[model samples]
Target: MDLLKKKIQDEGKVLSESVLKVDSFLNHQIDPILMQKIGEEFAARFADAGITKILTIESSGIAPATMTGLVLGVPVIFARKRKSLTLTDHLYSAEVYSFTKKETSEISVSKDFITSDDVVLMMDDFLANGQAALGLLSIAEQAKAKVAGVGIVIEKGFQNGSSQIRERGFNVESLAIIESLADGQVTFKEEVVSR
Candidate 1:
């Protein structure tokens, strides 16, 4: 995970006190090798969780989730934000509010993809306020699926997101935990802050 932290340090842009843009090599433009390594790491961490499926939200979470699925030899299911004509019925849905986008979206997944017999692992590119993770958890609840754990690629540890998930009695593994993004500086959770 040091490689990922280093990548963020090298290319990540702290746009504001709460916003860090990593579109250069993560969400927008992806590094396949890095993504593969991320997948391997996640697989290793959750190798004993009896994971049957990988769940992620649309757009940003796809790449990392797909790679994790590939490495774990499991199918990845991404919740679609936009509604499609075919995604009309037998779906598990939840209301998710995006902290970065400042918007709410109804994320849905097909019931055919998930079941009560499956153990799901929620994966995301980033975790801020835990809204998206909560949404996925809601969907999993509706499906009566067991949650393996939550895998976050880059977590804003300064936020209450990770704590919220932990409070719910689920394991959360974040590869790169950013303690703060203040004054246009990136601070990892491991580094002590005097202030």
Candidate 2:
């Protein structure tokens, strides 16, 4: 996680007060070695939950989620933000608001991918208002699947979303949490694991 924090510090950019873009290494062009490390760490953390599947949203979350699935040897299911023609009515759905995009959208997963016996590990690239995680959790609920835990790459700790998710009694782990981004600087939570 120290490596990840350092990567963000070295290459991440703040697009606004709410969006921290890591398009160089995370949200866009990816570094697979680093991604594999991240996947290993996450797998180690949630290894006892008996996870049967990895769930994530489209675009950004796919990389880490897929990495996690590969490491765990489980299937990775990505919820599509943009519905396609091949989608069927047998899908579990939830509406999530994107604080970055400044709008709400529906994220859905095929019912065949998740089932009642599944213990889902939800992963996302960022956690701000918790909308994306909430939507994924909603889908898990609808499927009657148990949420094993949630893993986040970067969490804006100053935001209310992390607290809301914690209040739900789910195990939440974030690699780097920014306490503040004041004065054109990124101030992260001091509890970061030492390298």
Candidate 3:
């Protein structure tokens, strides 16, 4: 994850004390090589979880989740923010508040994609308020799927997201955790070696 930390230091922009924009490489215009590395990291971390599927939200979370799925040889399922006509009524839904957008939206996943037999590994680009992960967990619960773990690319450690998820007994792994983003500066928490 040193490579990822270096990438953030080189390209990430701290918009404010609470926002770090990494659209240049992480989310908007993705760096597939970095994503592949991230996927490999997650695959290594959760290698013994018996994961059957990777789950994430639509849009931002899809890239990393897909890459992780590819590495783990598991299917990826993303929760759609907007319900479409093509989707059937048999779905599991939850309301998630976006830390960046500052709005709440209903996220849904088709029941057919997840089932009781699945051991799901949830992945996301960022973890701020833990709302998205919570929503995904809700969906997984609705399907009776066992949550294997959560893999996050960037975690805002100043926030309570990580602790919240941990309190719920979910094993959460974040590649780079920002301890502070004060005065447009990014400070990371001491990296825990996890090869």
Per-residue C-alpha lDDT of model 3 across residues 1-195, encoded as one tens digit per residue = 789999999999998899899999977999999989999999999999999999998888888888899989999999889633345489898888876787778889888899999999988899989998998999999999999989999999999988999999999999999999998888999976866
Please tell me which model should have the higher lDDT, number 1 or number 2: 1
The TM-score of predicted model 1 comes to 0.93
Q: Report the number of the highest-lDDT candidate.
A: 1
Candidates' C-alpha lDDT: 0.91, 0.88, 0.91
Residue pairs that clash (backbone atoms under 3 angstroms), model 1 = none
Clashing pairs in 2: none
Q: Which stretches of model 1 miss by more than 4 angstroms? A: 83-88, 191-195
**lDDT for each residue of candidate 2 in 19-117, tens digit (9 for 90 to 100):** 678889998799999899899888888888899999999888888888888888899999988533345599998888876677778889999899999
Tell me the number of clashing residue pairs for each predicted model: 0, 0, 0
Q: Which ten residues in a row have the lowest lDDT in candidate 3?
A: 80-89
The lowest-lDDT stretch of 10 consecutive residues in candidate 1 is 80-89
Which candidate, 2 or 3, would have the higher TM-score against the true structure?
A: 3
Model 2 global lDDT (CA atoms, 0 to 1): 0.88
Ranking of candidates on lDDT, top first: 1, 3, 2
